[model samples]
Target: MSKIGNDHLTETRDHLINEIDSLSESQLNWKSNLESWSIAQVCHHLVLVEESTIKAIAWGVKAGEPTQSERKKVEQHILDRTKKIIAPKIVEPDTKLFEMQQIKDLLNDSRIKLHSLLSTVEDKSMLAKKSVKHPALGELRLDQWIEQIYLHEQRHIEQIKEIRSLYEELTEAFSSDHIQ
Candidate 1:
């Protein structure tokens, strides 16, 4: 992966950390609606995603070869928020609640593992020599998989913001109810 890609990944990670750090335990676990995921769930889902993506990419790099394709363009599709898709069940977050610190630790560990693996690569071209399968996007080489990881986190960052808004609204409403 390119240095810029790594920078983007770290930037998104920092943003996620900041966003979660600002929430209280109740806010982290609050759901805006019956169908929406709590911020904690979103963080847990991201942890699962990064862990799985890195593992799959590492395995593919060791055991397989990349296929010819426009990986960059295909991976860019993941950044489009208007295009909604379901996540594979294997990567789904646990329904159990998570503490903010626990989520932070998982994210931090995952980042370290990923950065360590990618940093060991002396030739960027080698990324193209291997590929992994994304449940929704199908086959993606290492570079594309890296890009998708960031894009996926970004999508959830937006979700986190929405959850923040909902939490604020709910808190305001509850506070008002006791004002009289």
Candidate 2:
């Protein structure tokens, strides 16, 4: 396993775990607007994306041909706060709001699968092979895909925080009205 890749996966997983731990069930289900995802939905989406992307990476590796396009260094552009990319319909969150424990279990299971895949790579250089075609980003290697998963989690961290902020605002307003 690439220590760096595993480290990133672990770090992002922990950060997500901590972020959602304090939120109440109502907060988790709250959306800032009709168009936005709730915290629960975002968490669910992360689980879906991580699992599918890992599978795609594994499938690409087994298929075994280096991509024709020269692999450029994969940057963490997904983490950019200023830019927004539309999620492909395949990855859109399920309508049901998942329980917190269920979301955590799914996330952990996906991470374990990811670690297992990384362990099979004997040479770190295979990361540059660009073996898989991502729905949004086109061809990417296993390592880059792994990095993208973490970066995608980071992107949703901001959304989760925004959800929390809006939830807090609503709570405060309701509290003040009751007091009045």
lDDT (C-alpha, whole model) for all candidates: 0.81, 0.80
Error of 2 at 101 (Å): 0.7
Listed per model in order, the count of residue pairs whose N, CA or C atoms clash below 3 Å is: 0, 0
Candidate 1 per-residue C-alpha lDDT over 52-153 given as tens digits, one digit per residue, 9 for 90 to 100: 887877787676455665565754577677887777887777877878888889889888888887777777787876776778877777788888888889
In model 1, which range of ten residues has the least summed lDDT? 63-72
Off by over 4 Å in 2: 72-76
Error of 2 at 149 (Å): 1.0
lDDT string for model 2 (58-93, tens) is 786777666655553555567776877888887889
Global CA lDDT computed for model 2: 0.80
**Which candidate leads the pack in lDDT?**
1
**Model 1, runs deviating above 4 Å:** 64-66, 72-76
RMSD values, in order shown: 1.8, 1.8
Cα lDDT, model 1, residue 156? 88
